[model samples]
Target chain A: MEWQNELTRLVKTSYPIVQAPMLGVTTPAMVAAISNAGGLGSLPVGGLSPDQTRSLILQTKALTTKPFAVNLFAHQNSPVNTAQADQMLQFLKKLCAQHQINYPKPDLNSIIFHSYEEQIDILLEENIPVVSFTFGILNKEVIHAFKEKGTVLIGTATYLAEATLLEQNGIDCITAQGMEAGGHRGTFLDSKTLPLIGSFSLIPLVAENCQVPVLAAGGIYNGKTIKAAFTLGAKGVQLGSAFISSNESLAIESYKKSIHDAAETDSVLTKTFSGRWARGIQNKFMMEVENSGLAIPDYPIQNALTTPLRVLAQKQNNKDFTTLWAGQSASKAESKPAGEIFQKLIKETESLP
Target chain B: MEWQNELTRLVKTSYPIVQAPMLGVTTPAMVAAISNAGGLGSLPVGGLSPDQTRSLILQTKALTTKPFAVNLFAHQNSPVNTAQADQMLQFLKKLCAQHQINYPKPDLNSIIFHSYEEQIDILLEENIPVVSFTFGILNKEVIHAFKEKGTVLIGTATYLAEATLLEQNGIDCITAQGMEAGGHRGTFLDSKTLPLIGSFSLIPLVAENCQVPVLAAGGIYNGKTIKAAFTLGAKGVQLGSAFISSNESLAIESYKKSIHDAAETDSVLTKTFSGRWARGIQNKFMMEVENSGLAIPDYPIQNALTTPLRVLAQKQNNKDFTTLWAGQSASKAESKPAGEIFQKLIKETESLP
Candidate 1:
């Protein structure tokens, strides 16, 4: 199977597949394993402090000298809305009681976030080869600074407008995030519009409209999906949910097991978990919190508030309370070494008729 | 390009493309024109009286001796809620006043609809060779009756479960309607869930999981999209918006003009026009109605109530008031003979790398 020249040249990988930088799930070892296996492996440093980000980058570098990317959340912290947060907290408390677990009030005032500026400084110091961003776009100065150092920039877009904007901003690559993709939607423009586009629709539009190299992301898995992405004019493919259940992914065993056993219909998009709409396996927390009609805080705040429940659920192995972040194609995912999954993906892509 | 065996055999068409039976648009000439071009042409007979249905079927038969499919809306009528309908009517009245047009009260009690059973009876009596349906599924008895007459059955599904249900009931083919498609969602299940799956994601899932042959729909217009669909495991493709601007289509000049002038980001899903979620180019009606937050009556009722405004809008060449139902790729649609469009699509699909 022939591959797009731009992606191969830009990422300098043997294959066009990318192991997605899943927050809280992908580790340095997993990233290195994939990078060493001929695919670009990404480190998601969205919630990490500057020191931790530096340490992980060094750790990944130490593990593999191959080129890899570091991903960051480019979003500005949303203003804290106490009333809305409290109502959602009340709803969560009820669910916790039902599950026989204690719900602690989140430290709203002490809520801290990783500023992209600090992360960029660390990336610049380390001379990171590739940097990818989600949630929002980075400012012009930061993007310019990274480019001056010969760092490749990749941005995520859920719509054609975002892809066009990213292209206009001189980004090196764009990942078209279809609605079928799990985790937070990479919609940088109007989040209120809600992501209604599928990868099939978004990929072609972005490819046709944008001049930059395009990476198809979302529900893509296996050889057929890779072929479909290329057919849609995407240069490469980035996958998150497919790796969530991988042996190398950092998700809890129960979370991985849930993804393995999930049906295609088991996933749904809900903002109850993180205030930003995300696709994941439907759990009691999602259904009940969503049905409650209670106002929820914005991202980072809602995400931070739910951290306790997620941690407790993991410890107890109560799958009902855990957020099994997965995509519509989660059922198709298999738990295996990241290297094996990467090799299989490449083999399957090459074997397509 | 080689096509799937089951689809080519089932439709008896040289090419693996289906011209979607768009409501109140596709004409007998268009249907016959497509059928004569070696592609399946479908007649949208939904909401018509039994006599009208028979007449249209006869009209199409006279135009094309080749096999074509008769399509119906197999949905149960939503119960009338007078309170909600009244509130929406008032909202419409105010909008009409703002537009300097008089609004008349609809005959609420007399709002009647054509049942699918009667439509099926007409189709069977006419000995239609092939039949397709959207909005909902047909009952076992109706399906059995149609099959007894050697009629081929096609059903629409937005989700995998819907496709499975259709397959279990002995559907001959399934059209996977991704979220990017224009017009009313073919979703028969909870419309409240909102169709979130895209064609790229939905087609593969449905194709991989369901037993019946799959036809990819939504956002497909050009040869590249057709190639992408096939690569994702679709046996054929069903196109609606692509033909909306065709010279053979029955859409008004202004409506067709709007589609021609559309951009990649011009369309949005709104419930204002039909009280059912539908994707179309945004206009004053959509913006105002949505912003009004006024309760709208169930479909058919709302569809009937808004007819006069659409008629006036077309007469005035004001595209804002008309329902320009189009898929996300409507901007790529061309105004040409249906035969020419079908031939081009076939050529493009054949020429794909």
Candidate 2:
């Protein structure tokens, strides 16, 4: 049951589950141990600068030599204009005055992170095991480049039509995401469609119709859903929320503990956190931000403007100001060390009674 | 491809699509042509007498000796006490008067046309080729009795858990219904937990998980969907809405025309018309029933009480008083001779572009 079909041959994992590479939560060590324990591990690089991405990859490599994946946000790059940035800075300055924090000058918006080209170059330079992209399609040139470099390519899609689009665009595998998954929104594939498919509905539809293997993600924290995904014909499962507090993760300790203390219904999707849509436990700043109805900045700008506040809130152990992004299954998150957590996941898979 | 499925073996037809047995619309001739064309034809028994069920079986056989399925409502008998029936009738009396129909007494509640047990007995006695139960489950004994007599026992479930429930009991096949299907709302598996697994979500999930044969039913009116269903691993597909307006069907011409003018968003699920959950085109009667705060009786009784109004509405071609049960794919419906429709459906599976 553990070693069935092409997925086992590709990943060399015994179970049909992969600990998903969450941008800020999943660590290189976590990915390595999970892969070593018979499941694929992933490291996503959306929140880091290009040099930072290079450093994280180097650091993750030092921790483990096992095969692992790295995820990239393929959304286009653009920064907020100085005028909008200044207005946003003034608004934040007022909030800082109210909160009694010295308003820092906003040079944070200048931080341009790894473009896919830059990231792809680093991945090829380091010979990364697998490369996955989300939030948009990879064009022909990129696909050809990655194929030449012997990368296993995967695409994230929230609907069958989008999964079909990804397949048409030459993705080796498709991640059929549900509405329940946390982190940055993956609605880029079908920004125009009215109906969004949930995980329970999307996985089977994509799996049944697509010729390639489908990886199920979103709200899958345990072995029960792992089994359910396999039963739904998913060749593999990608987990997002289960690795938060693992020893390999770099998120603030307070952030990790908040995940452990979360409730099933605590998570809500709001652009307030990042300007782009994301799911996190409802926090004070988020609630206030949500109701402010101020024309917020788009993806990268919104993410940048909120960074100072999030960092300050984190430094102060203030869950209210921090983003605290979590999947719907956050409450079930465990605080175990990375290696043991993977082993426990496998153990739980074995112990389904 | 027409020869590539269980539906071909069951109905001995070239097309796997079945014209759903709409309670007030389907007729013996419609079922006969579909079965003759090598697709399952369903004769609805929810509105029939026990004698009608027995005679319809013989009538269908006289028209065509081909195999066919009979659909029945299997709600757990909610005992109808005299007082409850009186209260419901008195409540409906004012509404019936508003419709300009004769206010009949409450004899309709006591008149159970066909108990599930008695209907099961009739099918066994007649040795019908197939039987599908909806609205809820029948006892295991009924399933065994039908199967023992060589009847294929199909159960309809709105969610996977209920499908699992049917599988745990003794069902030969299961229908994964989405919110898009028409007729009486058989969503009683659990009031709160309707998975509403639309065809896009349900077909592959059911096909992958259930060991029994899986049938894709709901909102499917085209060959592309039938072909898609087979690709998703469904052994066969059962269509209910496509045949509603076949040349052989008993639906009033006005009803058939109404179906043609429908848009994709035209049909919605409402507890109108029959006082049971059903998906249909919005009508004056439906709007009235919805506006009235009076509670409705469960199946059969509510269905029976409204029978007079519906019949009178049909006689007068009055749209307001009749329940037009239609699935969401009503826009795609084409009125043809049943055999021609079946031929096109089978041809679609055989020849894909």
Candidate 3:
């Protein structure tokens, strides 16, 4: 089987498999391990500050000379609505009290949200070879700057319109994120009604229309699924949940165990944790918030408000309060080293016709 | 490629493809055409009267000597609530008046709700060789009767639990109906929150756990998707939207045209038409009902109220009022004869590795 395709050549990797860049779960060591093992590894800086992003990139660079990608969150910030924020704070307080947990008072004024624009200088300064973004597309100036630096730009799209828009705006590649994908959706066109097109339908449609190569993401955890993506016209495949249980992943033990014990139907799309919709295991916090019928504040704000609860949950090893982010096929995830997982994907794919 | 798998052998078809039995779209001519072309054609009797079902079976048998299957609606009938029905009637009348269409007066008492149990005697009398059902599993007596007649039984499942239930209840085969599937969801375990697992994730999970042969359904149109389904642990593939544009389909010209122009993101799941959630093109009727926020009466009652509107819409060639049921990949459907579609599928699969 021929493995040298446009995607592999563009990423400069031995294979087309990509380790998805998941915030909070991805570590510099995991990214370096995958890149060193001949597949493209992505380091996520979506929630990190400029200094933290630079340090992680440097750490990954020191660990491996192989090319890896850096990821950014390109969502536009919504203006803070004080009334809604206060209501959410009250709701969280009452809920935390019920769970016999301490509620940390969140200062909305003190929360500093980093925009993708602020991270552009760091990427240029670090001389990053590849950059991928989710939640939305980057502005023309940012895209131009990346292209001027000869950086490969990969945009995440959950709809056909978004995919075409990415191509028209000079994006080198598009990652077709399906509904089964873990983490926040990359839908920018119509966020109110999230387009939940699956990979089985999304890949062929995007690949057929877009001039650039399309990488299939969401629910892809093994070689058979990777092969299936290729057969459905995807140039490559990106996997996130498959690495959730990996030894190098920063995910806590309880979070990893929850994924291991989950079934295909266990995960659901919810906006209770963050204003942006994301797939995760159904836990008590999510259910309680959803059943309360309170409107969640927009992204950054809600994410900031829930930080203390999640951190405490992690410290106490309570899986209920933390976001158990995973894809629909999280049950297939195995606890192993990142390099071994990458090698097993290659072996499984090669063994098939 | 060897097409002689357990699925093919059980259905006695040359290829491992099944033409989905879509109510109101599948006709005797279409069923015979697909069966004659070496694929299993399924005739839908879910909405037909016993005599009509018998007549359709005889007509299909006369057209083709090859084996085919008969589909039934195994959903339990919900009791009709008069107040709810009256409210639905008033809503439909207002909608019809706004569209300048005459609203046919529907008599609730005159509406005959047929059960799967009622259709069993018809199937037995007609000596149907193969049987398939959607929405829920059958009782033990029904299964025993089919087994005694040597009829091949196939059950539709939208979740892993449903698939396992079907297997445990003596179902010979299971069709893993993904979220991308057209028409009504076959979910029975917990219908309140529909399971939206994609085929990429659903197929492997169900196949890995169930002892029966699994068939992948939803978003499957061309040879590449068919090949992808097989790679994802599906023994065979069942296609619904692909045959929507066939010459023998009973769908109105306007409905067919809607599917021909639909994109992967055009279709959405809504329960406005039948109380049971179904995927269809976004149109005026679906939008109006959904936006109205009226509580739709359950299956038979809602279906009855909408029947007159759908029929009149078809007569007047109004695409907005009729149900344009289609899968996510309706855009990939080609207008052709049913037999030609089947032949093209075989040729395309054989040409691929």
Candidate 4:
């Protein structure tokens, strides 16, 4: 069975599997390891500054000469609303005080925020081979610029409409992110409600509608799931939770342990963490914040406000405070090197009838 | 390409496809058509009296000699609270008045409420070959009786735990119902939140854990989805929304039209219809009732309160006041005879690699 399809040919990988570029979880070594092991590894630079993004890409390049993708947060930053920010700050302060942790004052003004536009020049300068983005689409000019550089562009979509829009905007590939996906949903289409289409539905719907090759993401952790995605018309599969426990992942030990010990029902979608819906294991913070019934500010604002607490929690090894983002099949994650996991995925998929 | 798996053999069907027993939608003709077309057809008697159940079974048996399953609502009726019921009644009266429809006075005492236990005698007397249930598990005595009669007992499960429990209770097969499934969720385990696991995650997890043959339900519509379910480790596939528009379905013309016009994003999960979560197309009644924020009575009570409105709406061809139960891929539904739909499903599955 030849696995060399349009998606694999476009991405220049031996297999159609792509490691999901999960923010805070994906490391440079992990990206390089997956890329070197015959699958596409993605470096997540969603909230990173241009310098940080450049350094990570350089580190990955040093480890492997294989093609990889650089992912960006294409979401437009919402204007800071002082009243809402103050309310959230007070709420977080109360939560921190109750937990006996010092609440660090967030210097919102001093926070260095780099837009995807600002990082594009750096990506071009570094001669990155592939680029992927979520939360929104890039402008026509930026897409034109990437196309000129001969870089393969992939966009994330939570719905068929979003996938169609990505294709119209000249995206080379579409990653159909299902509701079972762990990180922030890439729902950019304006609708009265959130689209929670699962992979079983979303993959075939998007693949049948869009001419571009579609990669299925969310709840995919093993060879069987990979084959399921392909059977549903996906050109490839993107996996995040499966690699959260890999040796090269940047997730803390407690987070990795939670993924290992979790069940299928353990992960849930909650907006309290980043004000954008993300799937993670339910914890005290998510429960209390949701139960409080307070209006959560939009992302970047909520993300910035909670950064100090998450950083402190990470340092203290407190799983409750930090976001333990994982897909529905977190329990299938294995504690192995990224290359070994990649190799196993290839073997498992090949062994399937 | 032979589809003679354990599930197919157990159900006595040529194809491992089961037409979902959608309450208020499935008809005797539809059941018989599917059964005669080499797939398992199910007669839904979830809320019907023994006389009604017997008539439907006899009607189906008259149309086809092939074996079919009879489905029951095994849910225990909650203690009726008059205060809550009265509140719901007042709310429904107001809604009816607003719609300029006569609100029929519900005879609470005269309501023909029959338990699954009572219906068991009729099933046994009729020598029903297959029995499937949802909402809760039947008692040990009921299982023993069914097993003694050589009945193939199938159970519905939304979570892996429920599937495991069903397997432990001597269930012959388990239907892994994903969150994308329409109608009431069969969540029996007590939990703080609902389990919304998708088919991609739920089917594989349930299939791997349970010893019984697993059937994947939810968001499955065509041959490609059937293959996807099989690849995900399910031995068979159960689909409801796909058959809603068939010629033999009991769904009203307006309801079928709404399903035909729906997009993937058009359907949503709402609890306002029956005080239990069910997916359907978003309509005026669901939105208005949900916006009212009035406390909804438990099932059977709430189901009773909304019955008049739903029935009236059906008569007037008004889609706004009725439950338009459908899965996420409702748009994929085709208008055809049930036999044609069944044959098409088999043809599609066999055509896939």
Model 3 DockQ reads 0.75
* Interface RMSD, prediction 4: 0.9
Report how large a share of the reference interface contacts model 1 reproduces: 0.59
What's the C-alpha lDDT at position A118 in model 2? 68
Write one digit per residue (lDDT tens) for candidate 2, span A77-117.
66666676666667777776788766565585456645676
Model 2: residues with Cα > 4 Å off, grouped in runs: A12-14, A78-105, A108-113, A191-195, A251-258, A261-263, A350-353, B1-353
Give model 3's docking category.
medium
Query: What does candidate 1's lDDT look like per residue over A62-93, in tens digits?
Result: 99999999999998987788888777777788
The sequence of per-residue lDDT tens digits that candidate 3 reaches over residues A1-353 is 67889999998999888999988899989999999998999999986788988999999999999999999999899999889989999999999999899978788789889898888999999999999999888898999999999999999999899999999999999999988898888888873357999889999999989989999999898879999999999998999999999999888999999999987778988888778889998889999999989889999888988988988888888999999999999888889999999899999999997
Off by over 4 Å in 3: none
Model 3, residue A62: what's the lDDT?
94
* Per-model TM against the reference: 0.95, 0.57, 0.98, 0.99
Best by the DockQ measure: 4
TM-score of chain A of 1: 0.96
lDDT of 4 at B3: 91
lDDT of 4 by residue, A1-353 (tens): 57999999999999899999998889999999999988999999997888888899899899999999999989888888878878888999999999998979797677665789989999999999999999999988899999999999999999888999999989999999988888788898897699899888999999999999999999898889998899899999999998999999888999999988988788988888888988899888899888888889898788888899999998998999999998888888899998999888888988998
Error of 3 at B19 (Å): 0.6
The full ranking of all candidates by lDDT, starting with the best, is: 3, 4, 1, 2
* Best-matching candidate per lDDT: 3
DockQ for the candidates, in order: 0.56, 0.05, 0.75, 0.81
Question: If you superpose only chain B onto the true chain B, what TM-score does each candidate give?
Answer: 0.96, 0.91, 0.98, 0.98
Stronger candidate by TM-score (2 vs 3):
3
